[model samples]
Target: MAKQYVRKKEEVLQTTVTSIRHNEYYNMQKMFDELYEKSSKNESFESLMPIILSKENILLAYRNIKTNGGSITPGTDKISIKDLKSLSSEEIIENVRHIVTGKRGYNPRAVRRKDIPKPNGETRPLGIPCMWDRLIQQCIKQVMEPICEAKFSNHSYGFRPGRSTENAIAELEKYNVYSNLHYVIEFDIKGFFDNVDHKKLIKQIWALGIHDKQLIYVIKQILSAPIMLPNGEKIRPLKGTPQGGIISPLLANIVLNELDHWIESQWENNPVAYKYSVRMNKNGSENKGSGYRAMKKTKLKEMYIVRYADDFRIVCRNKKDSVNIKIAVTKWLKDRLNLDISEEKTKIVNIEKQYCDFLGFKIGLKHKRGKFVTESHVADKNLARETEKLKKQIKRIAHPADDKDAATQTYRYNSMVMGMQNYYQHASHVNKDFAIVAWKINDLLLHELKPSRQKGRLARKGRELTPMEKERYGKSKTIRYDSMTGIPIYPIGYVQTKAPSNFKRGKTPYTEEGRKMMHKDLSINTTLMHELMKQTVHGSIEYADNRISLFSAQHGKCAITGVEFRDVNEIHCHHKIPKSQGGTDEYQNLMLVLNEVHILLHATSNETIQKYSELLQLDPKQKVKLNKYRKLIGLETI
Candidate 1:
């Protein structure tokens, strides 16, 4: 028995040794593959294939980085953007060239990952790409974007350049112009990006006209390279591209476009009809004023299958056609692409009889006045999802102590809310239902801006404090502003503007000195705040959105002056009763005026200003400010 046990132990030891040797051989094979790739550099352009990954391409890539936020994280190499930017232009070029050419073996160093929550309460792993890796990927993407854009079908909008959900929505809405009995089938691929079969994806790309051997070699090497996880364990992905990589979206689009082409081919023999009617002016052509004129009769059957990334919507004539197409598509996906259909999500519904939720819109036909009109409204689930995200962002922005930063946050918050509203604005319930919700959110945000009532106030002993004492108390006291729900907080400052209304906020004139003082007081950082404050009013998003609506409604012409607002700076909002005269903040009493007209009204006497104000149909208040410029320029009151 002892002899048998010893023999068994020896056998186990031999097996372990063999396994270790096998792994070593496998790792060495990866190195050999890279070496072979390097050796092929001497080959002709015909053999090597030209690509944007070369040294000459780094300039445009660098420019894009600089134009972008230029944000970067310390990777495994411990290199950050600051370190990269510190180098001379020539040195930066050399460094990028070496990295792309794989002087050192290319392996992406992954950062700590956090799971992002989905609307369905499930979480998916999200990896942060190293800065160096991102730069390299960005360079590659610059090369690929235009090529993909030209080749990709206009119907496939997901992750492509200049395409958005709204674009896809607009394309889909084209069918809605006419009342047609269409069966809607929408589905998604299960774990689309995460479970992508690399070999199949590459093959599809090759079939789609990518014959570049060098690019292919680089892709294969990167895909095969081992990635270091957050826990410091290095593991190679078996299949599928990681989500964080910049090239992932482009590659995914390339693969999906093949699927789109195949589906299109299948529908050619049996085309489905999409009917719509556009309202034409008395002229022969469409009316330019009405952006997308409601049509009387239009047919668009070319887009039977509309795709945006993994989300797909197929319009068919009947249940039989829908089921047949779904089966064919699902079978092809499983058999050829090795991708699974999201069974629970894949469904067909008669949209004419019942509403089907597609890409956050509840789409159906509404019968009114003996006509069936296609109607789409914001889905309750999508609105709830967006609102939840907005709440979290608001909580984060509200926590900072600086009022300017808080204002900047408010601007961002309002922009996000407006973006949502833009998509849902055409919905029937938006004005009545969503508007109330938006107002309540604004009230909540305004309440946050006010000093927190939760903190204790300082009081004097046995006496009511005088105005002087109260002023001193206010100046001396400091209260801590705790962030809500433990959201991350950062101080953000508003971008100081030189608009005519800037003077109205305080006592200073809208001059260079006043602008400098405003900048100093706010501690404005132009680099950080410039893009964030574009089209915003003093960093107020709500104010900017309101102004935009008024500008559009009034057709870029001043209501009072009848002058075209060629520049946004020339436009101004005036109150019927000045705030100094105890006017309330009401929309009905507000009027749009030219900047010059506003200054003229404020500088002149109440009697003089009232004459023209009445002519302009404005309720002129008995409030005026003596203008120093009026006397300097010898200007008379209107």
Candidate 2:
């Protein structure tokens, strides 16, 4: 038989004496003598071991002394352990004093007496020797022991083995690899940490033969340690520690595995074969008469506990089977370990049809055709609304200057409009169109102070004034006020004493270059109208020169009606002509119209003009008339 390496208590005491002597400390002789005597009494030498080992330098010196024995002499030029141990108390005290005061040729290993420099370069005394180290030692005694004791029954379960099983199940489900229809169930154990039974844990630790001192220290650390939350709240662990810690999952899995074993033994004795079998087919064809035929049935022959730190997933089959299993597990934990489930955190959800979110992974049902659906479709209507509102607000605040703001607003508006156009692509419940419209309105407000490109002159010429336009033109420009603060801003320029002749004659303001300049001064008022009518008309006279070239691209024709123009200058871009007639400055509303015909159409009622415009179907009356003339020459029409 191999020799048993028994460590005697007396040997430990001797080791301590040797360690103290090697440090060349004189006053410790009495302390060493007292420790030896205490060890002989057999009255708990373990309690004093930590105090003796507390000084790192002394321990290191003792180790050196033990390693190099007789080769070291007492009082030779070289200092040695024998010299330290053989010296009288008075002699050793004197040497210690000399070393401390740096009088006996300064020992480099001795604690330096230099002042600690402040941040500002000023020096101060090195306060209290290793105060934190001493406190840590004391804290270790009070904390680590109790924690270890409470955690005695805990064991670690590595991820390698568990992940292999999970992956196997997934692959088997993929190729219909298993003969049986695969079913997975997941359950949560609530209030796991807070309900840990400290007393039971301590008893288990004692059963393992761990000393009381170590157990006490571990328990104290668990009780005293504080956890900081993301919201700045500090939480102290109550029953058990958080599951996110490195060792928590393994420990929790081991405890739950024990509970599972106990439950299985009980079920076997009771012989609830019918219940177990029924659970397996709860959602299967066997339950056709149970008013749940649409749901597939599954058998529950087994259960497993999967743990990621504190989060526990109890996977099983059949509702009744799962419920019974949960009840048994809960009871076992409560009776034996005093652990309770957190009802609020615990949830029972369909593992296959809907996803179960556990340990940051989402697991869901697999289709009969072998497609695995792992993601849950979560519709957060409020969140979407808030996000859209924030986006609009950000766009508004990002570029507030009127000139720069206009393009940004237009871009946002166009993007929203496009989304509405593609609204069918989104889920029916999303309200994508509504969101887009809301964003459009926000864009309008952001660019309220900006100017718009003027419509071509010909399209506006000869257009009659509507009652709304008359009122708008007649009303004096009032000082605009801030919507939020209600602070008024003075108008930049004075309103003209006389209305322009272009307004009276039904001619577009773009008839003369000088008139275009005058209109630029009035852009603040006309720009809003221009944007509103952009949905209907092509030309705006407010800022015409810059836009004239673009209008000529389509030969000054109405894009929708295919109305062509003979005199390019005579074809003016119309707002589908709405200053306020429920029209907006969108491309769909814009059309090229003959200047005179446009004026005539506006002079007529909207219903009457719409009828005529629809009849011609060409660019304007001039184009239609010209076509009729050509046909007459060709003998095609009268």
Candidate 3:
């Protein structure tokens, strides 16, 4: 009976493959000709296809199967990873290779609908790609990653290599610094993943010059095939590219690239307004004493759009342009791509009217020392909401009556806390309000350890600890607790709220231990600060702590004069390039100098600064800062 079942499945697969081969929808000749044309221009589609295809082997298939983990839900064929693993590794690899080579038919994917809870108490359908189907998708993704990485725009920060939510937010913040920002349009596509027009997506992929035969065939099947819902109902979607598959994001990005291109084209005609320079003197106004410096002029479009997956934030210089942009983009998505724009979700607001929120950060333009800089803060409301949600979840899992072990409870708690922290790290890094939230969450984590009140002889306030007690305890901040189990629970850790430095205790909000703890909590490496400071010290680097550290590291002495300054009031932070020429507050472009030396450096020619730097006999660190500064000012560095 089992042999008969296996034979029947093989017969069906053979028929499917035959149909795929004879499917006249794709023009093989045209695909080949296009590949040949692309081959002439550097590394082309065809040139790389072989390498991508060759990578499908037994080891990878086995690894992906093992990594797929527990759900093991079956596809349309009712074959799960458990069933697939029943076969030998060689057999599994051969089957996958055959499918990849178009010798076997692409299996119909089964859709398992998962209800993902949203912030507003609404749930959305997340389509779970089937076990076998996901395995194939993983293989395709591994091969296609390197080939696709370079093709996407830098403005896009979704699921691309070396890009992330932070990068996207940072770019948006950079734009906000210009101060000409008039309106921000937060655009949304209705049912973004589920509403993708399959045919339209295919055309967009072709437009991107991706026409590899196997690749196209796999995509077509993925898009056009019917999905079997859990209720034993098989439905073929009329338009949408299925939501929860590996290929879905890649496909969506390809379609959205068209929108990016359209935006860039329109910008050639719509230039932004220019205003007075934000660069300032110690008194917080442009240094008019140097000479009559002209304000920076703008020639490019005064508008830009940034996207992450389906979310888009468009910035424009004026209301007229904002309205026009929203209309154009709406029409373009509808007419060109057959995509629906969510009218309710598409919002345009004056930057002066209200702050724009995207990817969880509240973005607004703030006037800092007469210059406008983008101010980003995590919403207190959001942090509170997440904290409450986490409390509810932790209570359910770590119930007093539950039999779960400490390790299991700890694992669950860590996952929830880490995920929340990562999402809110940018805001948490600056928001003092986050400490309250963290304290509450820490209390929950403490309870999970089943700790009781500490029962020990306590010393009164102002009494010194015994010598043995002092020897037994170091300076780690901890909470003492007696445990229900024989082992006592140690301190429950809290997120550090400051950066550490060598400055006096009250000088800055950061401390050495606090900075290290903060970095660990944020999952950021200290090397990032070191790397930024290691480069030529400039104002373009916006991180103030590292800039101050660079100055302190150099012993508060003017790099040129080698004169020590006991008071920060005597020092000036100078921009390598004058504000009139588009210099920014980045660390690489800023330097601390004596107030007199600063005035001389700005008043004199670039040639004189270069000569001064040479005669000053700068140390290695100072030399790097001077060289970067010289490069910005178009002077030859020694």
Clashes of each: 10, 62, 18
Ten-residue stretch with the least lDDT total in model 3 = 1-10
lDDT (tens digit, per residue) of candidate 1 on 1-638? 00001111112222222222222322322322232333333221222223454444454455445433424545555666666766765776666666666666554555434466666777766555666676777666655554454456646756653344555555555544342536778777888767888899878666655567767776776566566666778677777676656677788788788777777655332222112333555423333222212211223132266677777787766677678878888999898888999889889888767777766777777778987766666677876776666666667565845544554554465445434544455454555445555555545455664446764111122122223223322232221222321111111111111111111121111123322333343211121121232333453333433443455455545665454443333457765566566654455445566664666646557754664354244333321222222333344534
TM-scores for every predicted model:
0.58, 0.29, 0.59
After superposing candidate 3 on the true structure, give the runs of residues whose Cα lies further than 4 Å from its correct spot: 1-58, 61-65, 68-87, 100-104, 178-182, 268-301, 393-404, 428-430, 436-482, 485-638
lDDT of 2 by residue, 334-376 (tens): 6887776656655655555555543223445555567543332
Which pairs of residues have clashing backbones in candidate 1? 178-276, 277-295, 277-296, 277-297, 278-294, 278-295, 278-296, 279-294, 279-295, 405-492
Q: Alpha-carbon error at 493 in model 1, in Å?
A: 26
lDDT (CA) per prediction: 0.51, 0.36, 0.52
Candidate 2 differs from the real structure by a C-alpha RMSD in angstroms, to one decimal, of 35.0
Reference-based TM-score, model 2: 0.29
Query: lDDT (0-100) at residue 552 of candidate 2?
Result: 38
| lDDT tens readout by residue for model 3, 344-461 | 8788987565778777667677666987755555665566676786677556444533222422332344345434443455542444555676577567755653436643211122
Q: After superposition, how far is residue 412 of candidate 3 from its true place, in Å?
A: 2.5
